[model samples]
Target: MFIALIALAVFFDFFDLMLSGSVTAALLTSGWSTRELNVVFLSVTGLGGIISNLVAGALADRFGRRRVFRGALLLVGLGTLACAAAPRMEFLIGARFIASLGMAAVPGVGLTLMNELLPVAVRGRWVSASGVISTSSLFAAALAGYLLLPWGGWHWMFIIPGAGCLVLYCLTAVLPESPRWLATRGRHEAARQALSKMHIDEDGPLLALNTLERSGEAPVDRLFTKALVKPLVLGVVLAVGFNVATTGFLTWLPMLLLERHLSISNTLAYNLMMSLGIPLGGLACTMLADRISRKAGIIGAAVTALLLAAAFPFTSGYALIGTGFVLQVSMGVLSTLIMGLYLAELYPTNVRARATALSMATVRLVMVFLPFLLLTLLNVAGVVGVMAVVVICLLVIVFAMFLLGIETSGKSLDRI
Candidate 1:
């Protein structure tokens, strides 16, 4: 039940992120160009992402995770509905940025809450299973866009997740504060109350009744102290690299196909097929997330993504779909299960939300300019050019893992 609620939170984010390729592609078919799409439209969304991360992270650290989480969902709901009613290109981009900001606010608070609340032994397993629903939002967006674009036009695509967000926001009322977070803030009564709600006794071996132990560390203003610098560097690098690799590739896919002369209907179908890989990848992680160390899983997935990306531009038809499926399957594992979970565990509770938000913020800020770089690359080379950048980033991830690898498997968050 707890995991299911968390899945609801994860679902809205992917629903927000996944709609871009198809939604933007529909606009392109209606006459938006490559230059206009990137410089004018997508840039706003990128800017929104940056703002959301910084603001949301700080708010959660100061005010509390639950409030920020609720506000973020509200933003997504309202922004998405506004997007559906947008009258022009400028309005659509503006509304989308607002929605993106809401969804963007999620990772730090939402994942932090999850890491604090979930069981130690099965944390990886639960996060991986939740990822199945999260990543599958891409497929849902694609299929919804594919089906409804013909009915009420592409405008209706934004409405689906808008409604989903509003519904989930209401349901989130049932969630509790993190006992770990409450304890840190000198709310021992609240902490105990929250823990009691989870039905875990403090004397249990699982918690060792030690949910209240403090490491006596000073408050963290910087994400990088000497002890944290290595993992922080690796986490930021990996976040930037993986996002640039997959989203950078996937967001441009529809345009790439259109540029290659595929018809709109076929382009929609192709992207839908590609989106299928998200859940498949998530499912793969569900099986392997606890079985292997996260560092190994991430490294392996990154290498596989690089290989699949290398073969992407050359394939056609069923083979093309197959390649996309496998590529995203690997990325889904790398992203949702390994990297997201690993970064949260690397930092301690005091600064966990802030650190996670900083990494996420940096990733989103870098991604803001990705469309510009991708446009330049497409002009000079093509899909292969984008893949070249992705491969380089993946290689960086491999290096980061080897340099900063630390196993967090089966360890309590408090112990870490």
Candidate 2:
């Protein structure tokens, strides 16, 4: 039930995230927004994410995961409700900015909570399984857009996920705090109680806590130390690379398809079809999570995705959809490996949430300016130009993984 709730929370979080692509396209077709205004919308969302990631990470580490987790859901739910009622593009943009705060933190904090709660032996598989469930939201958002946007029902897209998140907020009241986090904070009894609630034996975590480094330094400060600096940089690079490739591609794909002379409904249909690969990719990750090295999975997926993306501009109709499906599958693998597993495992319990936040903040930071780059490329060199940028980002991931990738597969969190 705990895993199920965490998965559901992540599902809504990603539903809102993926819904933006179709909503932006709808706004464009409805004459409610321009390309430039869309850029502002996306940038503001990123900026809000930047602020939320840092703040939520520190708060989760200090107060408790359940507090920050529930608070983030309430914020996102309220912000998305405001989005559903927005009458103007500007108001919608403002609402998105507010929602982005909670959206940015939900998946990361949830992953952290899951990592700290689950046993080390099955951690990778369960985390990847949750990712499988969450990835389905990509398809859900696309289907919602396909069904609703054609009939001027774009508002309902925001309303559904918004309501879902708020309901999850209430449901999460029974969620326990991370026992590992509690132990690291010197709350051994609380940690034991949390473990009991999960039906997990408390002896292992309580014993591990005795060996944990109880430093007085700030969590953020510890990120800069020599032992951690390398992992920190690698984490940021992987995150930035993944975000640039996937977010940039997914956000712009519908518009790019529209520019290719496809009708709005057809474009959405193709998007929906391509989105089918996401959950499949997650399933693949769940199978490979413990069986393969993290570096190998990330590098292999990046190379395959890069090749598939390169084929995107050369294809049309079913061919385009085929290329995108394969590309999304590859991306799903990267998402589960990087966001679901790797980033949380890199740091110790003492600073896990904060470290993950700092790494993920780069996603928002790059996004703040990514629209400008993509737009400029789209204007200058067309779809091919924008894809060229994506290719470059994927290539970087491939190289970085080979050079700096730390193998965390099958390792206990405390040992890592």
Candidate 3:
């Protein structure tokens, strides 16, 4: 069941990564003017992610993880088909938002559900596997682009995945709910029943629930309370820093390659090569997640990112490819580490999803302005110089994680 859910969630999570490389082609063929397409379609995509994540997090806390999990898949499937049939940019935008709600819900709640189900000893491995699944889907999406674009164009790109999501929704209903969430809601029998399905009979850990009860009716604003401030601030800052560097570099790589006198096909090939590097790096990091300190892993990955970003602009051929490989590996690892454990560590079970949502939302906001900023930076500073600035931001993240991040390996979600 765990393996199955991870596969389903990966299909949903990285569908956006697949779309990113091909969106311009899609927009050109769709016949919507740039004015309508940019503001409406892109805005809906970003906003849908933010709103869906926020709502899913809240619903996960108030109801249970499975409630949001099931609902999210249905929403994504419908949204995908809606996007396929979109007659105008506005209609597409709305449908994308609906799909995004389902898309975003999977991560925050899915992670929570996985953590709840697994014992601490294998928790890191479980989360790391989830990361690999997500990143691997990214590589697959790129492959899909290479194969599918010539035959069916963008609509089929979405149509196929949308149909796959429909099948996943059926599979999702058969999976067990989070026993931890059931226990907190005081449904002891239900919790036990769910746990039995997973072949466990022991009562689940109660630290998270006990902590929430002891906190005793604290207002939602307390998410930023003194004890929470360090992790919250660090989490948000690190999220923004990472996204700026990542989205900036990956978004412009093909154009950057073209500027260096490479042919268009070769430039795309390099990009595909980099995309292929993602899963390899992600898998390496996942293997160590259980063995290494989360903070140490993240700090190592950040410093490596800084180095890779600085090096990326100077080399080409084997050297450029080597640098891109290292950077993607580190970025893949750190992103998985941070998303898999950092947010889960920062907030107790009761508020974990909400806290993660807030940090992710801030990242999305930065992404909104990043495209133009990246273009300006590339024009002004050249690729090497732009990468240097990215390295500096990554340096800031290294410092933040070292000072403010918490170690979460083998810990209970509720205690975190």
Task: Identify the candidate with maximal TM-score.
Answer: 2
In angstroms, give how far residue 406 of model 3 lies from its true place. 1.2
CA lDDT of every candidate: 0.78, 0.88, 0.70
Clashes of 1: 0
- Candidate 2 versus the native: TM-score? 0.98
lDDT of 1 at 330: 85
Model 1 lDDT per residue over 240-344, tens place: 888788766777777778767898888888888888888888888888888988878988998899898888889988888898888888888887754458888
> Candidate 3 overall Cα lDDT vs. reference?
0.70
Error of 2 at 70 (Å): 0.8
Question: What are the clash counts of all predictions, listed in order?
Answer: 0, 0, 1
Worst 10 residues of 3 by lDDT: 24-33
| Candidate 2 local distance difference test against the native | 0.88
| Residue 240 Cα positional deviation in candidate 3, in Å, after optimal superposition | 2.3
Worst 10 residues of 2 by lDDT: 209-218
Error of 1 at 333 (Å): 1.0
TM-score of each: 0.94, 0.98, 0.88
**Local distance difference test, candidate 1:** 0.78
Task: Sort the candidates on lDDT, descending order.
Answer: 2, 1, 3
Give the candidates in order of TM-score, highest first. Answer: 2, 1, 3
Tens digit of per-residue lDDT, candidate 2, span 107-162: 88988998888888899899999999988899999999999999889899999989
